[model samples]
Target chain A: MTDTTVKEPVQFFVTEDPHHHDGDHGEHHHETGTMLGFWIYLMSDCLIFGILFAVYAVLGGNYAAGPAPVDLFELDMILVSTFMLLFSSITYGFAVLRMDRNDLKGTLLWLVITGGFGVAFLYLEVLEFSHLIHLGATPQASAFLSSFFFLVGTHGMHVLGGSIWLVVLLIQLSQRGLTHENKRRVMCLSLFWHFLDLIWIGVFSLVYLTGVLL
Target chain B: MSDHAKGGHGSLKSYLIGFVLSVILTVIPFWVVMGEPLDNKGVAVAIIFILGGAQMLVHIHYFLHVTIKAEQGWQAMSMGLTILLLVIVLSGSIWVMFNLEENMMPAHEQIERVRNLP
Candidate 1:
C-alpha cells in the first residue's frame, strides 16, 4: 500500500504504418513478380547465345584455306583481355555490395571501375579483330572466321550495352537515392553482369582454348 | 524485399573466393593449351571444359547468389526449366546442323540416295 500513488507512463514504438499495410503488401508482391519476369527474360537471352554457340560448333572447322585460330590468335593478348573482363566482374560485384550497404558514392566508384575494365576489354578485342582483318583474314574469308566474329562480336556488343546501362543506373542512383525499386534494378543488372561473365568463360574455354589446342 | 535485398547475401570473402577459383581455373586451362603439358589433346579439351563448368558454377553461386537458400520454389522451377530448354535446344541444333552438313558432302551415301530419289 506504500504504493504506488505514482503511475508509469506507457511507451509506444512506430514500426509500420497500419493504414497502408494492405496496399504495401500487394505492391511488394508485384515487385517480386517483376524480378521473376526479369529472370525469365535473361533465360531467353541465354537461348540466343546458345543458338550462336551451336552455329559456331557446326562451322568452327570451316577455315576455307584462311588463317585458322592457332595462326591468328595471340594467347597472351587474349589472356590480358580475359583478365580485364574477369576483373570487371569482380568490380561489378563490389558495386553491388556497395548498393547493399546504401553507400551511393562507393557504388558509383565501383561501377565506374567496372565500366573502365569493360572499355579496356572492348578496346583489346577491337584491336585483335582489326589486326586479323589487316592480315587478310576477315570474317568473309571463311565460315570459321564468320562464326568466330559473330559469336565474339555479339558478346562484345552485350558488354557495350551493359556499360550504357551502368551509366543510366548511375544517373538513376543519383536522382533517386536507394529506393526499393533501385535496389531491384541493381540486382537485375548484377545478374546480367555476372551472366556475361559466365558466358565469357564459355567463350574463352570452348572458343579460344579449345580452338587453339585442336 | 527479401533478406538479400537488405544486403549481406554473401560477402567480400565470398567474392574473393570466387575470383581466386576463377583465376586458377582459367590459368590451368591456358597452361594446358599454351604449355602443352598434356600430350593427349582429348584429355586437355575435357579438362578445359570441366573447369569451365566448375567456374560457371562458382560464379552462379557466389556472384549471382543462385542457390537453394535463395528465394524459393518458383525460382528453382524456372531455373530448371530454363536449363532443360537450353540443353535441348543446344544439343538438338548442333546435332541437326552437323547431320545436315554431313549429308551435303559429295561422298555421303545420304546425298547419293537423295540424288537418286529425284
Candidate 2:
C-alpha cells in the first residue's frame, strides 16, 4: 500500500518491539530509555562532586593556627568507617545483582543491610567531628579546617543521601515486588553508593593521609 | 540472564586492594606529620606523593568508571577543568600568604607578644 493510502498511518504498531505491541510482557511500562536518563543524571552528579573536590583541595591546609589534619586524625576509627562505607557499597552492588535476578526479597534484604552500614558510618563520622570540635578544630577556625569539613562533610552528606535512597528503594520493592521501575531505581542507587565509596577513598588519601603528613 | 552473571569476586577484590592502599597512604602521612624527620630519606616525600595520586586513580577508574564515553565525556572534561582551577587557587593563595607573612608580620605587635615571653 502507498504511504498516503494507508488509513492508520505507517507507524500504527504502537511500539518498536513486538513484546510491547500488545502490552503483555511490558505491562504498560518501559525501562531501557529511563535507565539511560538515569545514567545521564549520574554523569551530572559527577560534575557536582568535581566542584566540591576542587573547593576542598583549594581550602585544605589553611589551618589558621588551629588543630590540623596531623593533630586531628585518629587512624583507628577512620579505618573502621572506611570499611563500613566500602562494604556498604559492595552490598549495594549485590543488592542490584539480586534485583536483576528478580529476587525481590533478597534485593530488599541486601539494600537494607547496605543502608544500615551507611548510617552506622555516618554516626561514627559525626562523633569524630564532634570530638574534633571539642579539641578546637571547628571549620571556622582555619582554611585548612574549612577544607577538611567540606571534603568530609560532603562525603557524609552523600552517605546520608544514599541511605535515604535505599530506604525509598525498600519501600518501592515491598510495594511493587521488583517492578522494572524499582529495579532501575535500585541500579541507580548502587551506582550512587559506589560513587560515595570512591569519594571516601579520595578523602582517605588527600585529607586524612596528606593532611596528617603536612 | 545478565543479572545472574553480575555478582562476582572481581569487584570485591578491587575493593580490598583499594582499602589496603588507603591504609598505607594514611599511616605514612600520619607518621611524617607527627615528627619523624624526612630529611634522611633519599627519595624524600616525593615517592609518597606520587603513590597517593596513583591510589586516587585506582579508586576512580575501578570503582566509579567515569571516563571519556561519548555520552558522559562532560564528566571528565569538567573534572579536568576543576583540577586546573584547584591548582591555581591553592598555589597562588599559598604563595601570596607566605610573602604576606614575611613582609607584614614584622610591622605588628603580634611578633613582640611572642618575643617577650618569659
Candidate 3:
C-alpha cells in the first residue's frame, strides 16, 4: 500500500502599501485594485466596441452602389492621422515615465501633449467623414456606410472621452499633486488612452488601409 | 526632460522607420489595387484581410507599448482577450450577415434597390 500526502493550495490576498513605482517590483501583498478595476472597465468597454465591430463587419461591404472605399479614403490624409495618433500614444508613455520619476509637472505636460494629438486625430477623422458625406456617401446611403460610421464613430467617441479625461487629470495634477488616487487615475487613463490608440490601428487597417486595397 | 527615454517614440530613427513603413504599406496598396478592376472578389477579400492584419500589428507594437510585461501579465492578457472578443464578434457576424444578405436580397441588384429607394 502506497501512502499519498495531500497539500493545501495557497490563497493570495491584496495589501495597501502604496508607492511601489519601480519596475523591479518585489512580491507585495497589494492586489493592484486600481489596475484591476480599470481592467474591468476596459473589458466592458471592449464589449461595447465588440458589438459595434460586429455591426461593422456585418454591413461592411454594403456600398449601396455609391462611392465605396476605392473612391473615397485618401491615403495621404489617413497617413497623417495615423502619425498623429501614434505619436500621441508614444507621448503618453513619456508621461508615465515622468510620473515614475516623480516629476509631476513633466508628467502633466506630456499628458496634455498626448491629449492634443488625440484631438488632432479626431479632427482629421471628422474632416474625412464630412468629405465623404459631401460626396454622397452618407451613413443612410447603405449598410457599408452605416457600419463605417459605427466603427469609426465608436472610436472617435473614445478619443473624445480620453481628451476629457486629460482635462480632469490636469486639474487633479494642479490641485492634488499626484496623490495616490490621482496616481491610480493617471495609470488607468494611460491604459485607456493607449488602448484607444491600439483600436485606431485596427481602425486604420480594417477601415482605411484595406478599404483602399479592396 | 524625463528619466525613461527608452520608452515610446523615444528616438528620431524609430519614429522615422515606423512612419515610413506605415506610409509605404498604406500607399502601395492604394496604388496597386485601385488601378485594376478586379474580376476575382475572393482575391480582393484575401488581400484586404492580409493588409488589415499587418497594418494593425504595426500600429499596436509601434504606437502602443502594450508589451508582454506591462503590469505583470495583466496588459497582455487583457489585450489578448480583447482581440479574441473582437475577432469572434466581427468575423462571426460578418459571415452570418453576408449569408443573409445574399439569400435575402441578392448582390448588386439589392444594392441598386437600396439606392433607388425613396
Candidate 4:
C-alpha cells in the first residue's frame, strides 16, 4: 500500500515536470513573486505614511501658543534638501539603467552617488531639526510641533534605512558581481528609493510649502 | 510579458523628462510662494498643491515605472486603491475633525458666563 501511494505521487510529478521544466519555471516564479511581494510592501508603507499625513493635517495648526511653521521653517534650506532627494532619485535610476546593461562598475558608481545624495539629504534634515530644537520648537512644545516632527522624522528615518541598505547592497554587488539575485535586490531597492522620493514630494509640499502659507 | 519581465526600468530620455518636469513643477511652486508672483494667497496655495500633485505623477511614471500594463495590471490597480483610500482618510479626517472642533467647543459667551458665575 505504501509503495503504491509513493508511486502515485511520483507519476503525478513526472506529468507535471514536462510542463514546468524545473529550472525556468522556478526562476520565473521566484522573480515574479519577489517583485510582487516588494510592491505590496511598498503599498503598505504608503498607507502608513498616509496615516501620518492625516495626523499632521489634523494637528498641524495647534501651536499651543508656541512657535509656528513660518517661524521655524527655512524655505531656502528646505528647497536645497528637496533637490538633494530629487537628484538621488535620478541617480538611483541611472544605477538601475547601468545594472540592466550589466555594467557592474557603473552600477556601483551611480549607487554610491545616490547614497551620497541620500546622506546629504539626511544631514540637512538633521541640521533643520537641531536648529528647530535650539530655537525651542521642541516636539513637546505643541501639537503642531509633535506631528511635524513625527511625519518628517519618519521620512528621514526611511532615508537613513535606505542609505544603510545601499551600503550593504554595494558590498553584495561587488562580491556577487551582478548575479541574478543581486540584480533583483537592486530592483527592489530602486523601487524603495524612488517611493521615498515620491513621499518627499508630499512632505515638501504639504509640510514645508503649505506650512509657510499657513 | 517581455516588457514586464524587464521590470520597466525606463529609458534615459524618460528619466530626464521626469527630472526636468519635476524641476519645473517644483520651481514654479517655490517661485509662487517665495516670489509672491500672485497677489492672492489662495491662488498661490492652489498653484503649490496642483504643481505638487503633478510632480508626484511624473515621479510615479518615470522613476517608479508604474503602468497599467506592468505586472498584469496589478500595479496600477493597487495604486488606484491606495489613492482612493488616501483621499478618504485625508478628507474624512479633516472634515470630521473640523466639524467636531466647531460644534463641541464652547462659545466665548458661554465661557464668559461660566467664569462670571464662579
Could you arrange the candidates by DockQ from highest to lowest? 1, 4, 3, 2
Which residue pairs clash in candidate 3? A15-A29
Better of 1 and 2 by lDDT: 1
Q: How well does model 1 score by local distance difference test?
A: 0.81
The Cα RMSD of model 2 versus the native structure comes to 8.7
lDDT (10s digit) by residue, model 4, range A1-214: 2222233333311221233334645445555667878998999899999999999999999999999889999999999999999999999989988987889999999999999999999999999999999999999999999999999999999999999999999998887677655777899999999999999999988999988986
- Isolated chain A TM-score, each model: 0.86, 0.82, 0.83, 0.89
Q: If the candidates were sorted by their TM-score against the true structure, best first, what order would they fall in?
A: 4, 1, 3, 2
TM-scores of all candidate predictions against the true structure: 0.86, 0.67, 0.71, 0.89
Residue B76, candidate 3: alpha-carbon lDDT = 72
Tens digits of lDDT, candidate 2, B1-118: 1222133213546656655665565456545644556764434345455665675676566555446652235546655665676566556766776787677758658688879999
True-vs-predicted CA distance for residue A180, candidate 4, Å: 0.3
Q: Which candidate is the best by TM-score?
A: 4
Fnat: each model in turn = 0.66, 0.14, 0.41, 0.68
Tell me the tens digit of each residue's lDDT in model 3 across A1-214. Answer: 0010011112132323434333454222132445666766877787787787677666677787877887878877877887797778767777876776779999999998988898999899899989988988898998888889888988898899889989988997888675545666777787788678667666765677567665
Winner of 3 and 4 under TM-score: 4
The per-residue C-alpha lDDT of model 3 at residue A192 equals 85
Clashing pairs in 4: none
Alpha-carbon RMSD to native, per candidate = 8.0, 8.7, 10.2, 7.3
The TM-scores that each candidate's chain B achieves against the reference are 0.79, 0.58, 0.68, 0.85
TM-score, candidate number 2: 0.67
